[model samples]
Target: MIVVALRARSSWHKPAWWATAFGAIAVATYGILWATPVVLDGMLGGRNLLTLVRDAAAVAAVWFFHNAVAAQQRKPEKKLPAWGLGLAVLSFTVPFLLISRPGPTSSAFVLDRLDQFPVWLFSSIYIFIVGALAARAIALLSSEKTVMTRFYVLGLSLMLVGSIIELMYLAATHFGPTNPDFRESLYYVAERPFFGGIFITVLGFLWVYAVRVFWKHLARWTLRIDARHEGGEYLARSLATSSENGWSDRQLAVNSAVNIRDRLKIGTQALSRREHALFSGVEHLLSNHLERTPR
Candidate 1:
């Protein structure tokens, strides 16, 4: 229980994972905020509100990748994680029936044109949209991929680009007949760009966020490597200094031996000179004694 709770808290710190989680949540939460514009009488504009939610969701999802992706692999596999992926895929299919298909045949209804689809169809569409986005939230936050984690950063980056393009198209088209030049426009084009772009460009934030998370992981490993290498080098230098000292000592001993040898030679020469002088004095005294005895 402690580990689970700790993991949950760490999840938000991951910028990429957070964005992704938020994006998924926004997709689901659209139901509650979708009609906010009608009751409040512009208390909160529809487009801006939806854009904010969507962008917020995207940011959350990005953070999820950062916090959980690396750690997810270590957890035990449960049946619930598989169910999540299925739900996410199902969500995508519902939009096909509710929103018009991209090519041509898919049925799509404008939000303003409520008469086009029955109430039941709208409800079904909402549920599916929520499921689809929620699935992404669950999949990214809960699952752990080993090889995929090793390589998927680039893939996720590409996926973000595709999502942004799709979101841009949706935002551009999901408009009412309100002209900005007239008083009918709830918000200016500039406002929509920031709001809508939140969903699309949240990916850019995710990219930087991904880099930051990975860098934190990379930094610790690098510091250890540096410390080990530095220590080894220092030890080697000490050994080299010791070797140089040994050479200096050897040179001093050789110089002392040469000085001792020179002193010994000078002492021997002085002793020989003293002996020669004593021998000459004794020979002169012996000759005088022999001459006096013969007389």
Candidate 2:
């Protein structure tokens, strides 16, 4: 007699990434749908509203690792994760300060672009930086032995390159148009290649290398493991929209400190004492409930 055994699902095989991807798409969608209303308009304080969403995505990425993305039996990092998340939440305020207050002096440095581009552009960067840092933390979990590889280092490097571009753009308005020759070269570089240009190109190659090596292992989880379980099969269903609905509450729970995102995504217009207390209360409740759930 031949028999088929239904395998009991492991905790790691759950729909966490699906939820993470969902939240990412929802924000990206919010950004796209409201691009004109929130991103392009600074007259009615829409820019700050957009900043809220950007920061929330950052906080969400941080929380994802904290709550859903970690390995089974693995511990989260203590320091770098905090730093990554802090910068992500803090990055939201950069635009508000640039746009708020009296005169052009509030944007004392090269942050003029805060006024020029929609907040979503920079917010996208903030989210990516947060994700990169979080990925580095995940990679570092195995950094002690031979498994400690180039992926973490590469992620750090990409985050630095993107950060430098952001900082330089803030410092000078002519960053992209520095010189006709440089613009032509860089523009062409960005068009054909993913990262493009000299430094970014180098980092791009490194990112690919890191992705190749690290994802070779991660693909086991992303693909090979999917072959083994129903939940994994669910996760594999959408490359664009993973089970985003799965871990959203988890995202919010870990990022309760990241009020910037909480405000924007939830569209909290003003945080009076009552609203603040309510949000605080809700976050506290969620945190407790999250601690109990298996996901």
Q: Pick by TM-score: which candidate is best?
A: 2
- What is candidate 1's lDDT per residue for 26-143, written digit by digit as tens? 6554444554323322344322333333433443353344334434443333223435534543443443345332221111222233222332243333333333343343455434
User: RMSD of each candidate?
Assistant: 31.1, 21.1
Model 2: residues with Cα > 4 Å off, grouped in runs:
1-27, 30-48, 66-73, 76-91, 94-157, 172-295
Model 2 steric clash pairs: 18-242, 18-243, 18-244, 19-243, 19-244, 22-244, 56-261, 110-170
Could you estimate the TM-score for every candidate?
A: 0.27, 0.35
RMSD of 1: 31.1
Q: Give lDDT for model 2.
A: 0.40
User: Candidate 1 local accuracy as lDDT?
Assistant: 0.38
Q: What are the lDDT scores of the predictions, listed in order?
A: 0.38, 0.40
lDDT of 2 by residue, 1-295 (tens): 0000121132223323422443454345334554543343354343335435445653554454334324322543333344655566666656545443323222121133334443434544554555455455445445443222344344434544544554444333343446445534543332232122223423433444355445333333323222323345443553323235543323423433343333435564345575456445544545654332111
**Candidate 1, which ten residues in sequence have the lowest lDDT sum?**
101-110
